[model samples]
Target: MCTFRMASNSNQMPRLDLHKDSKKLSRAQLDYMRIIEQQNLERVRRLAKQRSNNIMVGCLLGFGVLGIYGYSIYSVKQEKFLDELD
Candidate 1:
């Protein structure tokens, strides 16, 4: 018997399993399942790549902001020290 189940996550693809009799599935059914699986695999890969890129961009922005903040603090302290010398 061929059984199809929905994944726990609604965003994910359905899960298909062949149970009891492997030979019972028709050629068309097998072909359809194969196509769906391939599509899902491609979607997963694309999503993963996008997520990695987002993280990289976020980290770069965070570092840039921190650098700017640190530089401003250092400049303020330097000015204060120079003022005290005069």
Candidate 2:
């Protein structure tokens, strides 16, 4: 178990003065933000693709295992019936 304590000032958070004559962002800032956002989006897409691929691989493996098990059962039954006829 874990416990957390809140500070007294946490209730009354300080407000940011956005219009306090802040410095303007140069073209470099925009370019940097664009690149960061692009990379983040790419990462998300890659993760989604990997998840789908993993799911597909798992399904294929499950079917393969089931097929092998079913074939073994069928072959055993067939051999038993043939032996009985003999």
Candidate 3:
């Protein structure tokens, strides 16, 4: 009877249940999230304002350069027209 024990040959691995114990957030956690979200929105607004002002300044400078270029071309053309009439 001592030499009649059977040998086991099992190779199965244990499985884990991922969702067996999940906890919900408390009210204070939610309030903190809301405050963080509000700060993010304010930051976005400030960045947008800065972007718009930068675009406006760029447009003004562009127009100033184009105005000078156009005036120079116009003066040259007027001078050529006057010379042609001579």
Candidate 4:
């Protein structure tokens, strides 16, 4: 079990044992670990969202390029046909 004592001097920081093993961590250390874990989880979620957005943008750009290529081919075919008729 963890124990805490209030400091008599207002300017002094509370003493804590932060060097203990994980199984014997103090209350303050436990709270700190929880905060770190939550932050890491948030970071992972943000990275995943960014990756999905990049994939979507790439797919859209690829389709746009394909459409432009198809249109150019069709235009060339029409020009060839007109030349043959002349």
Best by lDDT: 1
Per TM-score, what order, best first? 1, 4, 2, 3
lDDT (10s digit) by residue, model 3, range 1-86: 36776565477544434355223556776688779999999999999999999999999999999999999999887776766787
Q: Name every residue pair that clashes in candidate 1.
A: none
User: How does each model score on lDDT?
Assistant: 0.88, 0.82, 0.80, 0.87
* lDDT, residue 54, candidate 4: 100
Q: Estimated TM-score per prediction? A: 0.68, 0.63, 0.55, 0.66
Total clashing pairs in model 4:
0
Q: Model 2: per-residue lDDT, tens digit, 1-86?
A: 99999667856956534356235555776688679999999999999999999999999999999999999999887776666787
Across 33-73, the per-residue lDDT of candidate 4 in tens digits comes to: 88999999999999999999999999999999999999999
lDDT, model 2, position 16: 39
Count of clashes, each model:
0, 0, 0, 0
What residue pairs clash in candidate 2, if any at all? none
The weakest ten consecutive residues by lDDT in model 4 span: 13-22
Candidate with more favorable, higher lDDT: 2 or 4? 4
lDDT of 1: 0.88
Pick the winner on lDDT between candidates 1 and 2: 1
Give candidate 4 misplaced runs (Cα > 4 Å): 1-23, 81-86
Write down the TM-score for model 1: 0.68
